[model samples]
Target: MIRTVLVALPLIVFAIAGLLAPLLSPYDPTSGDLAAGLQPPSVDHLLGTDQLGRDQLSRLLHGAQISLAVTAAVLALSLTVGVVAGAVAGYLGGRIDRVISRVIDMAISLPGMLVALAVIGVRGPGVVNLVIAMSLWAWSPYARIARAKVAGMRDSPHLDALRLLGAGPVRVIGKHLLPPALGPCLVYASTDVGAIVLGVATLSFLGLGVPPPFAEWGQMLIEGRPFLASTWWLAYPPGIAITAVVFASNLLGERLAGGDERPSILRWILPARRDRTVCAKDDVVLRVQDLSVGYPRRVVADVSYEVRRGEVLAVVGESGSGKSTSVLAPFGLLDPTAVVTGSIGHTKRVGVVFQDNLAVFNPLRTIGSHVDEAVRNAGRRPVRRVSEELLALVGLPAVARSYPHELSGGMRQRVQIAIALAGEPELLIADEPTSALDVTVQAQLLDLLARLRDELSMAMIVVSHDLAVVSRLADNVAVMYAGRIVESGPLLTVINSPAHPYTRGLLDAVPRPGAAPGTRFRTMPGRGGAGPDDSAGCAFAPRCPIAVPACGQGRPVLDVVTAGHRSACPEEGV
Candidate 1:
């Protein structure tokens, strides 16, 4: 609390000065004494006099009124307009949301100064004109922040409950949605105050803000610039005032947003290391060796795999087995907190398809636009033509005009595949692509993937918990348990003659061909998710049905059980 107060002190002081400039200032700021012009500090004028003979102290106090008043006006107008529009758009999604979002994006992309210059250029500068100019560009950031916040809450349970209680849209939004959205907006507004103040000063510096005889910080600086050498007091005072306010506003905002903790500057300054440590064979499309990922704790360790040209390596595991982490960390796709270390060698570009197509896509953007962006990123020319071709390749042609929310789950997944294929990648990684779809759609997608693989001769990595799903797609399979690959080999070899108990349990869980109706499916006894470093011995030892005392004694390394097949069971005895 004390730290926050200290951070806020400068702005508080400036606000007080601006609000009480009449009481604080000793003389009329605009009236000047020509005879006493450019005088140094004295008992009568403690801050000295400007070239126009205006009291520096009185001008500064009045300047604070002009600068901060414009800042306050701009901030209030922008915040109100931005927050209301954003909340309404987010609540009533679809075309309204898309249009508002597009406008926000355009506004944010436009240079704020340029927008202000354009507005002020059209209408001659004054306080009202200056406020309007700055408000135009300033509103977009608040709108974006509010839209994101409100969008996340649009489908929440509280909103649903309110709707059930016969609450109208206005009450629901103005009372509930806007209040929470205003919290973050206020934090952002705190920082934005500094920018608005600086902008006002800059425009005045360029002679586009308050006219002559007006006491503005920017006007004072411009007036003082010519006399900077003779009177250091002229420039330094307002400059110091501007610097102090900006610094204080930023610190206050940071405190409100994340408390006292500040992020490491080195994190932004230093570049990420992309050093490739190993090479793969020409036939090998990808070689991942000793890959480990953690959120400061080892979740995946010493994971290794290879995908050769025209081959599919399916990583089979239950939920939380680190299959997704192991694949995504190599490509820098995990959360920023994740610590990834290891070597991943791939010869060419890789494309990825994630499950949950709804989450993968922007609801505001059309499917075609998404594909076109990916296509453009891959250096493909004639973006529309190539994007259409890729969409047609994935059996989703002519859906370019459709938004993500408009498409069915199956069609959305197909669009995701098309986006992935936009790169014409040599290797494709699909993370549970068919998990959420129906059996029919799932089969169709798997067939489409297999056909694409054969046609393009691209290597693939398919991560799945259902071994049955990958049975028709994978050429080879790796079974993971507790962040370690317990068994791996050719699909048929591991499927028919699994050596590891966990693998056997997974195979048992799959619905067998001759199962009677109403039969209960096989299930493992204990839950399976454990990190690699959670135990001194094997992570899967606790859940292994056939485990002995020796099973938990030490970590078991994969040993060759047959030609092109391996199992990480100590019972195998290498």
Candidate 2:
């Protein structure tokens, strides 16, 4: 917060001075005495007088007011027109998108100064004309940015769901779409402020901006240019002012775009500590101790687990239960917003297979390129040979020449697996690997994974919301609720005789094999997962069926129910 304020200080001061220029300036900027002409800095005029004997300080103040007003006007006009046009084009993609995109490209391709000059030349130079000229080219860049953002989100499932619920184009765009699109546009606008200010000054310097007698920064610079050697005060102050605002504006944009985890500076200042605890066993491939990850707010808290050679550890929970966060945190896969504090001791070489292969594999690149790149990154020689072998090993043949989009979803997943295997990793992590596939495809992937695990003797961590999905692969199970591990033990022991209420609920929710045809699966009351710190007691207390008043009093810790089995529920014994 302090950092943000510090970054914005210059703009803040400039704005304040511009808004209160009349009250602040001691002498009228336009009215000047010939006797005071060419005077240097003194008590009467702090910044000295211009060639017209005008107070430099007063002129600067009023120049700020004019400059700021024009900048704000340009930004408002450009942002609104550009964002609206771009969003409409992106959302209603077809001939309209292509046309708008072409226009945006042409405008951007044209030199900005030339475009401005052309508009001012035809319209005649004035404050309004200058604004129109700058805005004509300026709005195009903003439109392009907004259009790209909206285009990416146009086909999202969220939009489909909104449309299903009878939402019209306006509400969908205004409420769901425009808000996210506006973020990037505003970030761009921060930097654009400097450009607009500079442009205004440049045009005014060329006598194309706010008419004569007006106290403009560019006008002052032009008027004082001839007297540069004698009266340095006139030009230096305005130049410094412009430079300061530009530098500050650029810095502010960077700050806004980067947020908390700025890789350029913040990462170096406070690096992520990877303090791994040494494992006693030589075969222990992965060990996580007290893993806690947060986005400033605690999400995954004090979770610990380990995977030995040839062993599989399954992290299972509902959405937002921190299942993915806990597993992915060790690999540094979470977004920069995440603040991970934990010790993860793992093999030097680790491979990961994400849930959505479509997202994982670049659509533009051929399957061969991705695999070859991975092979190269793993420090292997003969990239083509290694990539082909990896692809074959994953049961894919002749697919090296094909692009990611040309293949089926399952085929794409196999390609992802092939890419993961390129590293020949000692440990492999799959996060919801089969969540999006059909039953048959999911079974095939799981079987393939099992075969790989057995053949390679590699440790694995599989994350999923479904207990049944991980049953085929995982030897040990760790059930997470909120951000903490609620139950953990051998998969058979936990699944057959679950000690925690949440675990039992999850099991009950799964469809039984021999249940009556009309039987409905049980659903736990209340929401599934929340932040660990959201409640002083158990996060699942509201949803737990066998909850007692005591369950709401304090948080429960894992207690040994049987050998290798533990439950967080204090009432498990009862």
Candidate 3:
């Protein structure tokens, strides 16, 4: 609180002084009393007369108003330009990012003061010209800062989650990116106020500011220079005022810089509500048919899956098996370069818990706002009861006021779940939600998911490498290898009587606590790997111990093996 006050005091004082300048000035700044010209401090003229015989004290007070105004105007204009340019560049990336970044660098390379001076010299000194000149140079600092921050933040999991929630680019940027960026940008802009004021003063001293008779600090200094040897009052007061204002601004900037400046925690917590009521008739809440995701280097071909209402579908795969990509594609959150062809049916609403929880939140926004954004995007009506229930549901009732950084890893994941639950989504896609957590927390989260499924009757697709996590949460399992689903069946069938070689290997790898000591854990032979241009053959042939001679010719389709069980291998039939 004290820090906030200290940081705010200078700005408040500067504003007040500027506003009250007219009332506070003892004499008309433009009125020239020739008799008092060059006079030192006296009872009649408090700070004596300047070269033009104007009241120096009165002029100084009025001058402060112009300086502060110019500072504010330039700050506002520059920040607006910089933030918009940087945000667009950072979010879009590639060519757009490069173009904007280069432009910013070009602008920054120029000597800012020299450019301002040249612009003022050409445009002629006035408030409008001063603002334009200052902003031309001023925007670069903010742009650079905004670009760096946004570039690092654009690919955040929170943004990916937002994209999947049907939030358009504008909404995501406006609601999420802008708010977080505003705090640091505001600090930067405010601190630049002092510099802007000084720049205006410099221009005025160079006779590039407001015309004479319009009192300005720089003009006052110019007028008072001759009298400095005779009457210190003529120059001292205005000089002191400038010094005091600049000093206060600097102090405020420093305080704001050092203050508890993390993004608001409420942005992440408050808006999540589970309001979507489910009916039993909608058994297939989410259906992705013939889904294919194509990356620059590889393609996930003709993958089809269905998640039953309130049932979990676990997609298990090694790294780069396209499990995450498949889920992301159905959610309409794939990378721009990635082409997705598939129809997602009955996806009225979707919620996603990404692998990285920290990246799933806007650092600037509070937990409450993040949740609220999710709620709003989910098209759900605002209901306090629902929001509170969700917070409690995610086991993060007290973290409502905390930002993402303040929360622990487990806590952040819980918040992410709360965010996913905000819209009462019919389909929940969790991509390795427990990967970063300890076993205890992972177990707790999985249990929480089970409880949520029972209570909310939500359909979920959980992607995981840990078969145990999948077995615990999923009713159906799809084992993916090298961008293809090699086998899928009821969880019981796949786990107890696994058909695919990869599936068997995966299950066998799980450590048995009671196993004999010095026992080597079962390991899968061959690294399940494929190149982008690998022939349309079985992706897992190299790793399959049971691979037949025909396995290398063409990829086998998922053929039915048993009731609701399928495997894409000729060996399965053998």
Candidate 4:
């Protein structure tokens, strides 16, 4: 409430003063009485008299008229020139962009205030000259902003579709580019409004403003300057007015821009992964070797693992350790730009249960609708019958008519499993399946998956960050770091005795009730790996507590420590 009052109060006061100037004050501002010279603000005048004994209140009120007029005119003119120039330059690149950009560079190079001074000095300082001088360089920033906006939208699929549908330059700019760009462009323009007012006031105070007796705030300041000792009222009010208006516009501009700094959805979509195809020599349900995902930067690399019939292998890691990248390849969901090396071998049907069930299930469709569609798409049984059977199998028969949003998180996930099962897959990949559920619900889901795995004799690959989930259900574990699997072995063997430094660090970082009362919780000292950019060395070397000189020399390949157990490090300890 206080903020609203602060922002609105000045606006209301100035607007009314400018609009109702004539009626608000009875005295004629220009024709002051010599007999009442230097009157200390009484019934006749509210603020006090200036050096000329003019009614200060009346003059201040009228001064707003020029201030507002110049501000509005300058804004309109600058925006027109800037937005148009910037849009043309950015949208149509090549020679046109270069030429316009150079011109903008030149315009900004000549200081605006200096140019204004020269123009006003020659034109003999007045409202018209002041407006023209201030406007000369104002439009350049707006144009540059607009052009950048247009360039960003150039490769947008929707815009390309519009062009393919025969959109002209006018249609594209007016309908598509300008509207979205306007939000930020106007934000830039609004910030300049405050500066423009200050600039005008500054020029006026220095004697280049509208001539005396015109009732301008800057001229008022000059008139009040000599009375600094006894009368502070002379200089203070105009200064306060200028400060208020400029400060208010800055706050208003920030509000107008609607600041939201989240990443765009387009950033999520990259080039689909290209596979290198590593053919497995042994007979297995799924085999992937030498897999790396991306260009410019790789998220996951040197990945090699296999899943046998009825085997449950869990790929575990921290959030960005490439857990999702490792599992997503079998479903063919990796970005097109991602460079996926190593072949993924799977002969039978593959069923996938995604992490976010709310996003996976259509809000408009009922639980049964999805099941029915999946069953029908497979061409096996009647939609109603097969869907009902699948639903019953996953313990969601009562939710057949319920929409996805109507069900709880766990229930929605169960429905997703039922849909996946409709394909009768030999291999099922559940990515972060139990991460979003409560303890009770998670246990139930895990038991359900275990039951399903046993009943169907299915091979499963589960991807998760929660070591608890991995420990409970996985037959074997693949510990991932910086996109590569640093360790793999039987679940009990990996948990009871982790082989890699990263695997040990991950286990140590988890909080436990078994610690001493004053024991501080543990954390990995550095980032787990070489990050997305460093491609030459062992990713975990920087954070590895036992790291030696040889660790950073080159990438380490996985070596067998025991019969089925493996570790990527070449250290002495097995």
Ranking by TM-score: 3, 1, 2, 4
Could you tell me which 10 consecutive residues in candidate 3 have the lowest summed lDDT? 265-274
Clashes of 3: 26
Native-vs-model 3 lDDT? Answer: 0.78
At residue 182, give the lDDT of candidate 4.
Answer: 69
Please write out the lDDT profile of model 2 over residues 39-70, one tens digit for every residue.
99999999999877899999999999999899
Q: What are the RMSDs of all candidates, in order? A: 18.6, 20.3, 13.0, 18.6
Tens digits of per-residue lDDT for model 3, 1-574: 6766775675677577778988988888889978768877778777777876887777777887878887888988999899888877878889989999999988987888999889988998788998999899999878877877788888889998999989997897677877777677887776787788878887888888767879888878777787578778766776777776677777666555544443222333222222333335357877888877776666686788898777899999888787888778876787898878878786677888999888878886688767755654554443333445567778878776778999988788878888887765778988998887888988888998888887767788999998987777899999888777889999999988877888888888998779998999888887766632346577777777788788788767888889999988758433
**Which of the predicted structures, 1 or 2, would earn the higher TM-score when compared with the native?**
1
Once fitted onto the true fold, the runs of candidate 3 whose alpha carbons sit more than 4 angstroms away are 1-282, 378-388, 531-536, 572-574
The parts of candidate 1 lying over 4 Å away from their true place are 1-282, 572-574
User: How far does residue 371 in candidate 1 sit from its true spot (Å)?
Assistant: 1.1
Pairs in clash, predicted candidate 1: none
Cα lDDT tens digits, model 1, 1-574, are 8988988999999999999999999999999999999999899998999998999999999999989988989999999999998998899899999999999999988999999999999998998999999999999989988998999999999999999999999998899999999999998898888888899999999999999898999999999999998899898899999999999998787667555432221121111111121232237878889999888888899999988877899999999898888877788889999988888988567889887789989876789879877976766654566677778878887899998989988898888888887666778999998987899999999999898776666779999999999999999999987787889999999988988988888888988888899999878888876778635677777777777898777788999999999998968522
In the range 1-574, model 4's lDDT, one tens digit per residue, is: 4554466467557867888888886677788877776778777688888767788888888887778778888888888888888888888889999999998888877889998999998988888888888888888878878888899988889988999999998898887887776667787776687798888889888999778778888888887888877787777888888888887777666444433222221121111101111222123778887777875477777688888756799999988888888888655787777777777787567888989889997675688878877866655343465677778888887888988889999998898888887776767899999977898999999888998766666678998887777677899999888878889999988888888878887787677767888887677886655444344578887877888888888788888888799998888662
Clashes of each: 0, 0, 26, 10
